[model samples]
Each structure stands twice: as structure tokens, then as C-alpha cells.
Target: MTRCRLCGSEALESVVDLGATPPCESFLAADQLDLPEPAYPLHLRVCTGCWLAQLPPLITPEETFREYAYFSSYSASWVEHARTFVAEAVRRLDLGATARDAFVVEVASNDGYLLKHVVDRGIRCLGIEPSVNVGAAARDAGVPTLTAFLDPATGAAVRAEHGPADLVVANNVYAHIPDVVGFTRGLRALVADDGWVSVEVQHLLTLMAENQYDTIYHEHFQYYTVGSAIRALASGGLALVDVEPLPTHGGSVRLWARPAEAVGGTADGAPPARTTAGARGRVADMLAREKAAGLQELSGYAEFSARVAKVRRDLLRFLVDAADRGATVVGYGAPGKGSTLLNHCGVRPDLLPYTVDRNPYKHGRFTPGTRIPILPPERIAADRPDYVLVLPWNLRTELLAQLSYVHAWGGRLVFPIPELSIVEVKP
Candidate 1:
């Protein structure tokens, strides 16, 4: 019954019902288990009005983010990705020598993993992170951060204090926001007249095409295709300038936007060719590809619920078979996606005994409802488990390299999503 977050329309269509699952980030400690845990409807809906796919946040940002457990520093690959973005962004926006006093803002900046690189380059940067402990950590690392959630008002306050931002960067943080219009308007508010806002979101087309249902957790309120994203940005006075497809997060798109008012120039009777085409550039092509893949139509989503069920059954069969044979199976990372996948697949501690995380904050905590023990990597080396289940399959390359010790003991790696992929052990 919830209204669509994007178009403010009641004409919403159900995409999939992942059933009720606990808030993905609410990792619990042993003592906390005695208390009742809250779970919410993980139903996803699509807006017929705007064709945007989204989920009702089910919980407030405060409930989901405050005293957060997820940290970006845990992933070496993600950190490298951030570093690369900084380098390319400086070149793209000409932020290096010319835009010296330019203020760069990162929304939901975690542990200053990305901004630290910007600051190291002597560029002025600010991180707007909502999680208090996470913001303090960013500040501790010398990335000036505001301990506040981003909205239109927060955006105004930051602009008044620090002046307009030359470049506003939000990597994978935009999807987590429920009031994305307000968040986008905020980006439009603080961006310099001619400046641009850059965002990275996992493409919805990719999600549907690849059957990545594990990613449909409650923390992420929206998934965007190029067309839907451009429409949302246009609502907030921003226009898409260009887009680049990325390999990160299964498949993601990096969008560049400028003030809507700044799109057209005085050179002709109409706007520039790029601006006239809704500033499509390569973005129009991407949108056409999405349309060709049937993402723009309603029928594209109808089959997903059945697809999710089949994958769940497949994963359950694998885990049950492994357990019956007395083989050990442990998880690599207890991420939000992992929580959804585990709960959706009805995986319990018996099938997958425990999971390991690099973050010390999560080491003592247990996965939401499954109550799988979150342990340190040292435990894996100690136990030499027969099979290691990689929950964060997006970082499999980095994780496989780190967990190579398991292979030494005749162990193998397992991936559940996009079908079961068992990494072959090299002798």
C-alpha cells in the first residue's frame, strides 16, 4: 500500500516478495539474542508512473544506519576502486590545478575511504556520513565529516558553511536513501552553477538480467536504470550529462549530472546536441539497451519471483548435500546481501555453520536471524573448513586471494548466486 517514492503515484506493481527479513545491518550479539528482533516486509515494487523499481525502506535511515556495522576499509578492491575514482574525477572535473578552492562532497562517506585520497592530494573535501561512529572514524582519519543524514536542509546548511561544491560524489550510497528526491534536490542545491554531481548505482537492468535477487535487501530502497535515474535527477533540477558502465557491484553505472538550467547554451536556438537529447550522449544508448532487454516493460519483472524461488532451492540442495556428507561449510562475509540471500534461502547455522568478517565490530555479532557466528579469518585457518561459502560474491577475486589458505587443505570455495559456482582448487 505504500506510495511510490519516485513518482508519488499509487500505481505500483509488486516485483517480488522476499518475505519478511530482519533489517540487513542489524547484526546481533549473543546477549542481545534474548530480546525480540524486528523483521520487515522485503517486498519490491515498480512504479508504473515512472518505471522506477524500488522497495519501501521498511525502517528509518536512523534505524538502519546509526551505529553502523559496515565499513568500506574491509575491502581492498573497493578501496582501490575509490582511489581510481578520485584520480579520474579530478581529471574529468578539472579539480586538480584549476578548481583548487573547489569543495568536493561525498554523501554517506564511510571511514573517509574515498575522501582520504582526495584530502591526501591537498584537495578540500567534506564527507556527509549519517552513522555517528562511522562519521567519527572518518573525522579521526582527517576527512572533515558532518554527522548528519542528507536532505535538502542538510545540503543547504553545508553549502552555507562551506560554499558550493564543484563536484558532488556519492558512490553506491544513493540506493540506500528512501527520500531520494530530497537527496537529489540536495545535490542540486549545493552543486556549483556549472558543476556536476556524480553517482554510482548498480544498474537495475543488470540485476534483472543476471538474476541477482540476493541484492534486493531492505537497506537499498531503489534500483535505477539509466532512464529511470535520469528522470529522478531531472525531478531535482539535475540533468544527465553522460554515463559509464562499470564492473563493480555485479554491474553498476556511474552517472554525471549538471544543473538542468545549465544544459543549454546561447550558441543556437535550441540546446546543445547532447543537451537536446536529454544529455543522453552514451546514456541514451544504455537506455536503448535496457529497453531492448525488456527492462522498460512490466513483463520483465513478472518472471523474477519464480526465478528467485528456483535459485533458493538450488542453494538449499547444495548446502543440504554438503552437510549430510559431514563436510564443513562456512561463509566469508556477513554483508547485507548475504543476510538477504541466507534468509531468503532459509539457510541456518546447520547448513552454513558460521561466517567470518574483517570488521572487528562484526566479529562478536551474529548474522541477523540465522544467528550464524561471525568470526575472524584466523578461525578459518584454524578449522580448515571443507568448503568456504563466499557471501559477498562481488569481491570474490579479492576474497579468493585472501582465503587461498583453505585450498592448501584440499578445501574449495562456493558461490551461491547466479547459480552455484564452486571454485576449483589448484594442486
Candidate 2:
């Protein structure tokens, strides 16, 4: 982009350009396969002014989420993670004792994966989601949902109808919006004047450190470090009170914030000073760590492009070597990140042949740009491929256990991010 989206600065610097590719989640159907598909430039730029890493808003959220294919409930571990988060939030916020009086709202709540727990506690809850199909699924699960995107007007309407939320939970969706400031304000509008807002986004520090370039897709218009996150929240009159490093989606940060008014400042106005006692020392410590990692300046990103190139080269080498040896290699998951990795590495059906996923929505479709066929998980054992390329490597631990049965026929698994590695599994 010519100017940084957050600060409107012209001081944008290059981080990495992963070439052009189609929207990662735009899986093709059998009939549409013969038609031409569009691709967009997938370049990530960092703003010196705000230190916010971002991509051009080539695709809108409506194009990606209107009929979304991802369902959070498909992953058993993710479900348990949501359950734990809800239990902890209830105790931490004392919502359980006043369940009848409390209301929880989750932005971008896919299929009520997290809000189901709130419903179980008898606390009023609502999911604000844009995808009609997934929102329908959430309602069928008995979780109240509003099928709409969260903008300032929508947020205000929700507050007017259901009243302000006691807690607003936004997980993994903060980076998905291009209008960072507007979305944050929508968050502020939805939350109570004395309520809390919790956001979980992939931390840029770990993304660069762990070489997680595949996570950069059209859907995620921006990336954030702790310092940048603080600024983003401040733009919406929310004060950062605390933050916790999480192990989800490679690496993430669960930020605990509140209305600036609740944190001893004016709301819906300019951000207040960062010296409030409500601001914990952990926030400062994380900022120090980010600065130590060279995130505040361009020095931290100097070597990221090279590291990303190495990943592309190493993966191609492995796939080529496997093909020459006449070994069968199928893919494990059809995650959006997989599209970036596959397209960036120039992998096609010839190299991967097909992939499998637990989610049935993608069963009869093909991956976005690579056009790799997606099948049911049972296909892995049916064909007994010599090697299975794991796409959602962020879930390394969980997938290892689920695919342990691959050991039956001397099969192995390949993980391609943070360097390529092949491992034998035992059940």
C-alpha cells in the first residue's frame, strides 16, 4: 500500500513479497476448475511510524467470509482450548456468580465454537459473524448469533438491542480486517463502559522468529507486535491492561483491555496516557522483549525474507526428491496457510496429488491456487501414502497424535515450516 492503513504514513518498508496468489480460502469446485481464477499481490510492508506490518487490502472480508468454509468445532483441541478460555474468563472476571446479569459477545465467532461454553453457563451470549452458513450453524447449536460484520454502526445497534456486553471476545479475527481502526471502534461500541475486551492475535515476534510466513494471506491485512497492538487498541479508546503469550496459531497474544473510561480516562476520544495503574507490568515487559527482538525498527525484519526463501527452496527439494524416488506424498490439511505455502513453493497437484481434512465443507473441493484435491481423512489410510505433508503445522502436537496411525505401513509425516523435517510416527 502507498500509505500505512493504521497511521496514514508514507514510510512503509518491505518485509517480504510472496509473489501473487489467489485468496487462500477460495477453494474451487469441479465445475469452476476450468474457469480462470484471479490472484493478487501478496506483499507485506511494515510502517516505520507505527511498526505495524500489513498487506494491501486486495480482497475484502465479504469475499472471504460471506460463505466461509472453516469451522472451528472440527478441531477437537481448539474446542477444548475455547472451553478452557471460557472457564478461566468466567472465574477471572467473576461472571459465573452473576451469570444471569452478564452478557458475553464474541466477534467473528465461527459456528459458536467459543460462545457455546458461555451458553452452557446460562450467561447471555451472542455471536457477531459475517458468514451466513457458519452463523446458521451457530444458531442451530442454540447459540444466539447476528449475521453481520462488526462495524461501528452494527456494534451500536447490537448494544442498543441486546445492551452493552460485559465481555467482548475477539480471537484470531483482529488481524483479518483491513480497517483496523474502525473494527477496534466497533469493539469499543459493543463493550460496556465498565466492561472488558479480550483479543487473541498471532504475535509478529513469533511469526518472524519461527519463520511463519505462510500465515500471511489476503485475509490477514495486518500483523502486530505488543507495542503496535497497544497503539491499535488505543486508537479505539481501549486501554491495554494485560497480555498473555499463547501457543495457539504458532504463537499469539491474548490481550486484556477495557474501555478507556473504565481504565480512568475518557471514552470515544483520544487515548489516555499509558501510566494508569490498571496497566500491568507485563505489558511493559512484553514491549521490552519486542524491542530486544528488534521489532520496533527495521533491523528485526532484515533476515526474514532470506529465511522465507530458504523455506521455499528446502520444501521444493524434499518434494522433488520424493517424486524422483516414486514415493507417494499426500497432504494432511487444506488450511488457508497451506495455500500460501503451496502456491509460494510452486507446489501443484502433480507434487501433492491430494490432501485430506476433517471438515466436510471442503471435501469435494480443490485448494485455491494449487488446485490440489481435498478428500476425507480416511483417504490417507486407504491409500497408505508413503508420506503425509502436514499443512497446519501450527497444530503440530495434535496432528502428530491423530496421524500416529500412519506408522502402520512405514509411513512418515513431513512438516514444512520453521524448516522442513520428516519424522516417523508410532502409535
> lDDT scores for all predictions?
0.86, 0.93
lDDT digits (tens) for residues 1-427 of candidate 1? 5688887899889999999999888999899988999888998889987788998867888888888998998889999999999999998778888636867999989899999999998899899998999899999999999998888898999999999999999889889888888988989887988888999999998898778988998889899988788778877888777788998988999988888778742211122344536445576688778878877778878898888888889889989998889888998998899999998888988898889999989988999978889998789889988899899998877877888778789899998877788996564
Clashing pairs in 1: none
Off by over 4 Å in 1: 265-279
Could you tell me the TM-score of candidate 1?
A: 0.96
Q: Could you estimate the TM-score for every candidate?
A: 0.96, 0.97
In the predicted model 2, the residue pairs found to clash are none
Model 2, range 102-169, lDDT digits (tens) per residue?
99999999999999999999999999999999999999999999999998999999999999998999
